[model samples]
Target chain A: MRFSALRVFREALTGHKGWTPTWRDPDPQPSYDIIIVGGGGHGLAAAYYLAKEFRRARIAVLERGWIGGGNVGRNTTIIRSNYLLDGNQPFYEFSMKLWEGLEQDFNYNAMVSQRGILNLFHTDAQRDAYTRRGNAMILHGADAELLDREQVRAMYPFLNFDHARFPIKGGLLQRRGGTARHDAVAWGYARGADEHGVDIIQNCAVTGFRIRNGRVLGVETTRGYIGALKVGIAVAGNSSTVMAMAGLRLPIESHVLQAFVTEGLKPVIDGVMTFGAGHFYVSQSDKGGLVFGGDIDGYNSYAQRGNLPVIEDVAEGGMALMPMIGRARLLRTWGGIMDMSMDGSPFIDRTPVEGLYFNGGWCYGGFKATPASGYCFAHLIARDEPHPTAVAYRLDRFRRGAMIDEKGQGAQPNLH
Target chain B: MLIPHPILGLRDAQEFTYLGDAALIDRPDGLANPEAFHDYLYLRDNPAGIHRELWFHEQGDRSWIVVTRNTVTHEILGAVLAQDVARARGRSR
Candidate 1:
């Protein structure tokens, strides 16, 4: 059933019982043409595009848990394409364009808000860095603006401008960057994939891979052994654990990144804002809760919970930016396991094992890269070639000394 | 998560920086073998239960310590100076 104003009006006139499930709960078949592991946003989007664009049939997405049970549901929901690197800017800008038409294309209300995002600067060096980044964004067909202190104050007057430690100098604003309903993104993609005849199987955890003479056969799952002609893995933080089952070790580490939401209040923040001197970035949700987060726990763990010190640190950063946030009671906090790559960039390439593909190592950028990640991943799986925009995401970039070190942090996963 | 430092008693986990797997202490000579270096730098044993990891006391005494902890429960079993562990393991660097 397509959602529209006419449908709503017709249903309101009737008994209002005309409704259907978002996506069907389908059982796994014996085999499929293509099977994607991890039914998060990327996997589901890949399946959707593979069916809709590539016109592929017999596609299936296997998930260990229900959809939206992973990082897709546990994020701050900010999206932007303000990147400095040539390898990253164009790709993210493509994602920004896709996000612009996502709601109409998927026929679901994913709440793709373009309220805008501001990255505040504290010092001269940071201003120069953001200036270079904003120029890069403009070159790549994405909108950007550098706002001075007066302009920033004119926009957000309640910020702590007179703080002694870190004074706000200026900011780089992207009018197209904003937050989306995270879970709704998952649901919309799942529904779109199902509409295109892609099977989305939940609670079907893949246990092992069936490889023979370097060619892939299929996967062994909790439900049963399902055969596939091609297989792709996009299990986010579980990238290493899952790929290790196929005798391939990835340059990835699992770290728990925590996020928090405050008690509902009147609208305060107009758009997403990040601290220049700290790791805290916050935005007001449509429901009025202040959603925010900071750095990762700096430890390697699969646990989806955080300790107290990081919480204290994030609170301090928030207070340092806006003292008004100190009064808002913290409602809840949650953690998501991030697959931090060595160079802090993602990978979308085929493995040495033929017919096996991998896509992960997103670090803090995964949520923002969901649409492009899926679109490019689908292009790769269908054509057996890397998308032009994702040529730099090759898994062997590190070995070849061609690392896309966006943050210039070398090969440290935690630092990235 | 309070890591009981062998010297400083109990310290907040945030005071230290975590690096996974104490086995990384035995660094392979990368110039000798590229594959060994790749394995040494990338591959790691991400077990679910008890494991030993490296933690730097960045905020406190500036000592590199090895902490034995459970990844599932976030329980710290023990913490010892990595220098002592390295010396005991016959490692110079």
Candidate 2:
């Protein structure tokens, strides 16, 4: 029948493995100006930057699946730069600026709601740590406010602030940290980049890189054998795999994180709130649904589906914060793979190989840092220099012990 | 919150009544004797004398306890096994 809808249905049911590209008498192009692998947010943003900012035409953004099909559409949609890490400070703070101007830049309504975010403290030590973080944020020119019991009570009166029991001592409030629409971010960047004459290639898988003497010349894809003067690797955790094809390895770990949203209610949660004593955070979406998330599943899995323990743990935290959430049923839950770096940050810089660049690893905070990531990564690739914002996030900082280490956790998934 | 009896090694679980520091910091004799919140009795915090102290049902595990303290310095001496304090409460019963 050759129906487009029927083709999509059949392809989806077949695990999407069969949908790999095919080269039947593939045509050969002389060379593309630039080739971007993995058309996720980072890749799409890279294409946009290279085209719009650098004025580089003949660029291609190749995706193995549909657009907005990867982590771009799979994150918890939480945006905040309230980190205690060293390198992350400038990087994410810069992202906050990009987020502020995104509406006009992309001409797309990203639904960036600045509902504020509060990290609750349960004990004296925790309070002291968050207070230090808040002060540090202020010193770094980011807005982080410390709130006391009375302040918290006045802010959210529905809280069970049994001062004697779970003593609602205080919290760290990041005024600039909030949520944004994830899909819209993808679409906005995509439409903007595509408008600049960047070829948005979907359903095309780059099978291997055609490297000559440790330098990438082009990529061999099932769609066709296309040569590019430069190649950019923006794939998240699968970064190591692609780089390995070019005979290189990066410090990247692929881990799974899950997010859950309850059925719509009458705007109970005004802002995002995270508990220090427990692993839970909750925020209300624009649709009146309480979107909540918790710690990663504490294990390495290619499986992008979350297990039961963390969900229960997060639900319990939501109930503890606002007992009223117990009445709202959990509507849907999903998971995404995160490329966790050793320092819980990202690396956006050119590679040792000529004409090759890599951008991956933002850990759990990638959603909030999207704009900054794209802009900074683009500067690195376009200008052929270390980005001013991500200069500390070089590939060699891990060896120098100059890691951001915001949570004081080590460079491991479980520790982070 | 302070329990009138020991819990860990004592006879039985003496219940704990949750209250603030202002209600139970000045005297311990009031706890030994029946009194009201406005009776103006609180933890003694005495050094040489047996002191009364407050504890909380944190985590809601419900382990009864009695805290001893130095009345002069406000230093907590020890929170003993409340079994004996529970026995005292049972004997009074």
What lDDT would each prediction earn against the true structure?
A: 0.90, 0.71
Residues A1-416, model 1: lDDT tens digits = 89899999999998788977888998899999999999999999889889998866799999999987898988999899998898888899989988999999999999999999999999999999999999999999999999999999998899998789899999999999999999999999999999999999999999999999999999999999999999999899888889989998788888889999999999989899999999999999999999999999888878889887889999999999999999999999999989988888899999999999999999978988999999999999999998888989988887887888888987678887
Candidate 1 accuracy as TM-score: 0.97
Top DockQ: which candidate number?
1
lDDT of 2 at A302: 46
lDDT of 1: 0.90
Error of 1 at A232 (Å): 0.8
* C-alpha positional error of residue A149 in candidate 2 after TM-score superposition, expressed in Å: 1.3
| Model 2 lDDT, residue A324, Cα | 76
Instruction: Mark the 10 consecutive residues where model 2 chain A has the least summed lDDT.
Output: A20-29
TM-score of chain B of each: 0.94, 0.37
Error of 2 at B49 (Å): 69
